[model samples]
Target: MLLSLFTVLLWGQQKETQEQLERRKQQILIEIKSVQQLLQNERTKERNILAEIEEQNRKINLSRQLIKNVQQQITITNASIKKNQKEADELQAELYKLKEDYAATILKTYKSRSNQSRIMFILSSDNFLQAYKRIQYLKQYADFRKEQGQEVKAKSEELSKALVRLEEQRESQKKLLAEQQQNEKNLQKDLDQQKGLMAIVQKDQKKYNDQIKKKQDETKAIDRKIQQLIREAIEEANRKAREAAAKAGKETTKSVGSGKNATFELTPEGKIVANSFKANMGKLPWPVEKGYISLPYGDQPHPVQTHLTIHNSGVEITTEGGSKARSVFQGEVLQVQVMPGGNKAVLIQHGDYITVYQNLSEVYVKKGDAVALKQSIGTIAANSTGKTVLKFLLSHNTDINNPQLWLSRSN
Candidate 1:
């Protein structure tokens, strides 16, 4: 009984794990499909080789992940199949023993089948007390026979169910194996496509390198401008705080620090908002409803040009065209930065922390506008390559942080 309970608990855990894997696989597939659509859109327009390659690289990575997920599922299925087979065998053995015992009991009862024989056996007792004891023995024997029959029936049914379950598990394993094979084929196709793209990229290394460098320079300029804006916002907030303290005739020196240090002197309300934002780290929602991180934060090697290093102050999330950017938390809009390309960026202040949503074609909220969590701030602009990417940045005062670290994993 203990072994059965343990097996049940083990199966429950494994089943839950399998379910989680399946859900993850589905999510990956959905993302792959979304990326595929973006690639198709890119194809419809003038070809931007670098952009195409990047999208292709993203798809290839997703394909590899999908294949890995399928492989894990197959592994789990195989284990379940093996476990079920062992269980079926054990049930069969137990059922066989039950039948054997039940047959013996039936045979013994058959030998004294007549009611008269049972009565005579009880009458043959020498005294009244002996006869009573003999009758009680007969009654117990009958009850034992009945219970043995029921036990045999129950064991038979249990064995049948086990066998059925074993067969089902075997079938499931077969289906999983087939699914794995198909995923491998799809992955191979993606890899082949990636190789071809890499070959094309290698043929004109200098041109692509120059293009990458130019883009990197533009990004660096934007990042610098963003940092300057954040510093200015911090200074402005601190300036206001100092003035308020001075007007109230309070000690401004202790209440508000110098803005040169790149920190905000928080008011009681500001402190609450800042504390709340800090407390919800890693629990913040994505700025876009449907998107994935195309580029991560900090310095990293370029996707195609591994020799070249790329620095990103924030994560670039690629989403469907025309998708609106939203605020991850409640905050007041600090600035609306308009870039040279006519695109805009909205900077929101949650106390000392600032969240920047860049690459927006249109802004919904202006400076000093109070915004709620998940409020639509602007529509993300699609680049020449037809890819709508949002450059999302997070900072505490003037200190940069990885937005990916703050955003919820479910995104």
Candidate 2:
């Protein structure tokens, strides 16, 4: 009984692990498709070496990621193959033992009954009760022999199935290995292309450096403006909460957090939204339905020049052209400001949290409008340079949090 329970538990764990791996594999495949689309989109327009390098960089990153995922799947298949092989061996051993027991039972039964018919055996008894007992013994002996034969047949069938399963797992492993190899080749090609581009870029180092500096300055300005907007939104939210509490004859508590960063004191309705939003951390949908993260949040060294660093207030997502940006959660639109580059940005107030979606070409939701989750706010701008990138920011009062941490895993 203990062995049976252990087997059941072990099987359950294995099944769960396989399910998780399968989910991961599916997500990676979706990411691969999304990246492929972006690459194709980039290729359609006029060619620029910088753009080409960026495209190759993204492609290589995705290819390496794909290879890693395939490697994980291969590991799982290998484990399954080993497990099946062990099961097959055990079943084979069981079949052998069962067959031997069955043969011995048959031989003993034949020896006992070789010279006696049922009627004769019964007649040999001393009295009526004794004859009846003898008849029952004969019936039971025959039943035991039949059961032994059935056991042998069942064990043999189980062994055959186990062997078949082992073979299937091996085949799956082989396919995964081939896939990994192909991804590796693609990754190497992209790497080589990136290296050639880097050489060209280094030759015109001053020109590229000036461009990088200009872009960095632009990013800092945008981030500063966004943070300013977020602060104002937070103050507005706090003022309303205080007014509401005063009307209800309740005291408004001070905001939480330390230093310059503080979360606003929420009203009853606002508190509900805040709680719900907090609960959905790392589970909220992306602003775009499908995309890949091109520029991640925070300060990092530039891809080409390690000496130069880049600062990003939020994550930059690359998506297909003509795609619309959607609100990740239900919120009241605070402001829809037009930035310096003619790019539009939408700020949505979700309790004490503020979400900003920038780089929009057109605005659909105006200030003071209540938007539902996943509602289209505006269309993302497709740049003349053949890039469609959306800048997404998440802030709690004055403090900026990485949007990637709040958003769901990309697939």
Question: Each candidate: what lDDT?
Answer: 0.87, 0.82
lDDT by residue (tens digit), candidate 2, 108-149: 777776555777889989999999999899889889888888
Which tens-of-lDDT digit does each residue in 1-411 have in candidate 1? Answer: 999899999999999999999899988988899889988888888888888888888898898898889888878888888888888788889888988988988898898899999899988899999999999998998899899888888888888888888888778878878887888898788788878888998999899998898888888888888888888888877778788878987543233344435788777778899999999999999999998888899898998888888889999999998899999999999999897577998999998899999999999999889999999999999965579999999998787998988999766
Instruction: Indicate the worst ten consecutive residues by lDDT in candidate 2.
Output: 253-262
Q: What is the C-alpha RMSD of each candidate to the true structure, in Å?
A: 2.3, 2.7
Q: Tell me the lDDT of model 1 at 141.
A: 89
Q: In angstroms, how far off is 138's CA in candidate 1?
A: 2.7
Report how far residue 199 has shifted in candidate 1, in Å.
2.2
> Residue 248's C-alpha lDDT in candidate 1?
82
Q: Give the TM-score of candidate 1.
A: 0.93
